[model samples]
Target: MADPQPARRPGGRTARVRGAVHRAVTELLAEKAPDEVTIAAVAERSGVHQATLYRRWGTMTGLVEDVVAEVLNRGSPIPDTGSLRGDLSAFAVNAAAGLASPMGTVYLRAIALGVGPAEGAPDGGHPGFDARAQQLQEMLDRATARGEPVPTLPDLLEVVLAPMYFRALLLKQPPDEEQAHAVVDRLLALTRG
Candidate 1:
């Protein structure tokens, strides 16, 4: 079991507990799937009581959501490079890199599993699928504000993102500058098409 007490940080007690729990869950994810991971594992890893894990996150999904939310929050920092092309290229590069990362892929796959079905994904008609499409739309809105006219969000995602994820996950290839440029150019063409 981990220490009964949590870290004593300047951010105060809640911060300390949250940090410990986050670390514990992160380490657990390194070794196991999110579905297989348990609250007891986190509690033992953190040296905190099982009650603490239950009280804090309530359930495995809750804890996983917290971790995912944190990951997304940090991952999608606004990319403002004055020009929409520059901003999108930067976003593509970052997205490519993230899809190739261990933590990022896991969260993505987990989220996919939570959705209704795979077949419904391509059409964006899944009952409970959450592709974070809103974030992409927000990016479009920001671009529009910058004088760029972007049509549907899926077109952007399919042309710019599909290839990145396809290569990163399916092809088992690393995300490189060449791939990022390819996606960006394709997306740029789509904007005109």
Candidate 2:
């Protein structure tokens, strides 16, 4: 298992520390390879002690996972736009916008390439994968609650997200609004009753 996210205390000392740490991680990643970003460097940039980083993050991979999580979690929660089509469309468009960013591309590549075994994951699965799956499930649950018939998780991944991720991660191209709308329309046509 990955370490749980830090307890959020808005505008408090803890939040400030996490924000500083996240900023340091972003700056260092922009400057160097993921493999070269060390706790000492992060501490130096963040003004948070190395000991605090070690105590909180446990390992380099743990720190990386947190950094990915923080970046991905910012700005939005999954869309809940009343109608399933509307929600999925909003989600796809927002996601495409995110993947289009340089930092977003770097973060995705790092998580896909560098994430591996950590303290809680003895079986060696990436927690980021698990986190993404959970997010997808939440979206499906929202759709179901809205009385839309949702596809199973595997089908959702295959039919809905696969094209989006393939274009964003593999082709290194973000979908335009028309492309995003097409994806949402196709998925809704397939799954909606």
Candidate 3:
């Protein structure tokens, strides 16, 4: 039979441990490459034991995955500016700014490497793509609730977002303010058409 689940502890030692671990992971990612951020290193930095990290996260990949998820959720919050265009433009600008940052580049590279070639990924795409897409869908859902005419998911991801990632990853050019707005305009036109 499976072992019993651990006892619950709300906002207690469990929370502190998780916070310390996450904070250590974030600081390490800012300073070092993803591969270099080992469990031992995190343990040393956070004062948490290596055994605890292994037991809680299973491995470095698991820890990094959770770290990236928290970063994405906290980093790319959906802005509500009382209009769809304003919201989309804000989102695009924020995304561009992140890609332009040194630590963001490192984090994204780590995410890409970790996700690539993972089993069951659609079309061998990034493993985190689904989660990212879900975040975008939630943003779109908010816009829809405000009576905005949003494009289909395929159109939003493939047509609209594809260019942004291409510029950041392939061209090595993260969009400036004008370029970000232009992307939003292009998407607006496509959705309108």
Q: Looking at model 1, report the run of 10 residues with the lowest lDDT sum.
A: 120-129
Per TM-score, what order, best first?
2, 3, 1
Winner on TM-score (2 vs 3): 2
lDDT of candidate 2 over 24-117, digit per residue (tens): 8888887787677888889999999999888888766677777776565553777777777777788778777776777876677657655444
Writing each residue's lDDT as its tens digit, candidate 3 over 1-193 gives 0111236464678767877988888788778876788899999999999998898877777677666655565566667787778877887888777767875675566566566454223564333455667777877887799898997767766665667778877788875777778878988999888
Model 1: residues with Cα > 4 Å off, grouped in runs? 1-10, 33-36, 116-139
Give every collision pair in model 2: 1-120, 1-121
Q: Name the TM-score of candidate 3.
A: 0.75
TM-score of 1: 0.72
TM-score of each: 0.72, 0.75, 0.75
Residue 108 C-alpha lDDT in model 3: 68
Which of the two candidates, 1 or 3, achieves a greater lDDT against the reference? 3
Rank list by lDDT? 2, 3, 1
lDDT of predicted model 3: 0.72
Q: Cα lDDT of model 2 overall? A: 0.73
List the lowest-lDDT window of 10 residues for candidate 3. 1-10
Superposed model 2: Cα runs more than 4 Å off: 1-12, 117-142, 145-147
